[model samples]
Target: MWRCALPPLPRYPTVDELGARAAALVARHPRDARLRRVGTSRAGTPLWLLSVGHGSRQALVVAGPHANEPVGGATVLRLAERALADPRLCEGADATWNLLLCLDPDGARRNEAWLSGPYTLGNYFRHFFRPGFLEQPEWLPEGADGATLPETRALLDLQDELRPFLQCSLHGVDVGGAFLELTRELPGIAQRVARTANRLGIPRELGPYDTLYWPTLGPAVYRIPPPRRGDLAAAITEAAVESTWFHPHPYGTVTAVVEAPMWGVAAVEDPTPPADADAALRTVSHTLRDDTRLLEEILARVRPLLGCSPDVARLLAPVDDYLLVGPGLADSWDPDLRQGGTRPLPPLTVARLTALRLAGRRVALRTAGLLHQLVTASGHDPRGVLPELDRLIDEWCADYRDGCGARWIPVARQVEYQARVVLAVFDLAERDARVRSRSGETGWGSPAAVPMHRE
Candidate 1:
């Protein structure tokens, strides 16, 4: 067992760095703890799962399921520490805690530049990476058993073996504020989460993104509509072909997707509806529509350039294709307005729109950069189009960052919020129809405050 080395706790660690830390902890407590190779990432990085506590009812908490969303790595590790220190954290409900530090190591390696950081907005946006829609874990495959990506298959295999009663996917954004996605709601879960998140200094997402399209049970909590057949493909292609092979994990398991922004923008937390709430929301819709239109315009310029270079087309066209797809929020929310009086744009609507647009542009810009490389590598000489596209993308990125002046969401807060939510949700499930989640409590200490041993 290697001792913890190379850095202090609470820092954003590389996939290897994090793996070492987890291994070191298991090394410390050999009886109740052991580390196992669940699977390997596409890039051939070993996927590690640290199991602490021996219980019948299983809970699997996955962090960095997506390569770019590594913020949860620390959160999952912290939870493992707590469980190890005080086994009671996993004592009830026969819950054996299996913490998967990150399932997507290949993409995570791409994000390592910003993982350990000054945690600045500029660094994050510059090094930002997210797997393409079809490449993600939960959303990647049509069914549970057959998965193209080794990472997905590994996770699906673990679930088959453990059939976790609860699954928590920890994810964070480079911009915007915190939000929660519930596959199914457990009573009293929302209030407990909101209170804990607030106490830990993380604000709920006030942006229109989650609120605009998804239904919220309470502040910042959105019920993610599970995908049916073809919904995954439809996400990319506007066309709906029946996805007969698709189905999310069955109803018995409860899952929570914790999405918190790396930098907490206080403005996003404000509940005061902007004075022109109605117009503000319409503007938000307009921004997405306009951005999508611009994305298509940019893609058109580059698509013709890729024809002869199937190498380039194979490598770069799908990225351009994704950008060509419309941002669906505009259409998804149109019905809400039809039933309404203009409610104030949720406090973070504009900021959310700004961040969302920025994320889209960043991906497009990366697409442009890769296209430029493909052009040069393919030996396509005299044409100057790719360079022009690169310059255009860089200019847009600079302008967007400068205009927003976004703050970095502190790493501590990000971890604590996620840790609390995972524990809270698991505790709720343990009660399993026992203790009713009561209202009226707006601050710290829920049934989740199971005595966790701290190091």
Candidate 2:
């Protein structure tokens, strides 16, 4: 948090609105704010970067790295506004601020329907639009395929040019609670972040989800360790992070990721489970296998339905390919990873898994929706899937609400929690820099994770 009274959290802006506001800052504060076009998005919307303060060191805050996570944009706008109004925001902190307000404008635009209020579980899942894990701009490749997305190139170019000392990529998730992913355990960072989150009443989600495949620092905070070559599939781990600018810094850059959830489950932080340990694991494993088979069946039904239409065929390819890859990945997880390790599973963890499944279903529904859009635009419904798909979506949404009733964190508080964690990371980075100047050694005081409890 800044050292002054802050304004009320601004309304969550639409992609277009965020861009317009970014541009507006330049005109409003000609002396303190300057805007530059980084590159154009896939849809030819100009990607803008706003700079406030002209300090010796640089700190880059990238918001809305993924399409569905517009809360990041709110954090960036507030940071930029504060830095401009009071240069001391970064004056003693020894850094200039570079804000990439909304990285994926085109995709974020697709989510504008839920960008503002009515921030509930049902409304969010209904309007969600996250690109495939590997297809994200934050981790896209530098080769021709990744180069196709102008947003990726813009981030790559900016990262290469600035070589920032501290980088914060803003991201949000739909469930469990607030969690963070960072490069390493920077000294004082965890405690500072904990304090901020506590003050804001954000329940720290002791991970049983994101930490399933990654290393964790403490409660609610996980570390994105450098990937080992054979840790898992190159596609899932390596290719997915080909151009993340935070890593490989000569001196480690204090990078942080805030994954604020749209909902909170107190059970997520508890270490107890409602069912027998082995029974829970078996059930989770069984459900994943069954769902994978179900997805395959849906794919089989969908593919031949689009037989002759090349355009609709293209629209369905992602769902088709994902069906092929998804099953194998689900099978690879051991029973422990599927559920919890040897320990009984909690209902909140189950809800987390359900949320993930809901995400997959929505994505498939989107592909089907796109097919409908294409067919309708062509004045035909060769596949006749619109009504069927609509029914399926409704059934899934109703089931989700029934399962996780009234367990949501509002839009405003989500932004507050994320912003507070980011500021704490920045503060930690400055402290570390000063430490290095005197003792010439890094000391984050974080020990190697032994996983004392099952995540």
- Per-candidate count of clashing residue pairs (backbone under 3 Å): 6, 0
lDDT of each: 0.63, 0.62
What RMSD does model 2 have? 6.8
For model 2 the local lDDT of residue 394 reads 62
lDDT string, candidate 1, 249-317, tens digits: 342456677787776555555665346545654655555566556556655665676666544544454
Any idea what lDDT model 2 has? Answer: 0.62
- After superposition on all CA atoms, what RMSD does each candidate show versus the true structure? 7.7, 6.8
lDDT of 2 at 168: 89
Candidate 1 Cα misplacement greater than 4 A, ranges: 1-10, 207-211, 230-251, 277-318, 327-405, 433-455
Q: Write the per-residue lDDT of candidate 2 for residues 7-93, one digit (tens) a residue.
A: 444457887777777777778778777888888887798888988877766778999888877889878877777787665556766
Clashes of 2: 0
Q: Model 2, residue 247: displacement in angstroms?
A: 4.4
Error of 1 at 445 (Å): 26
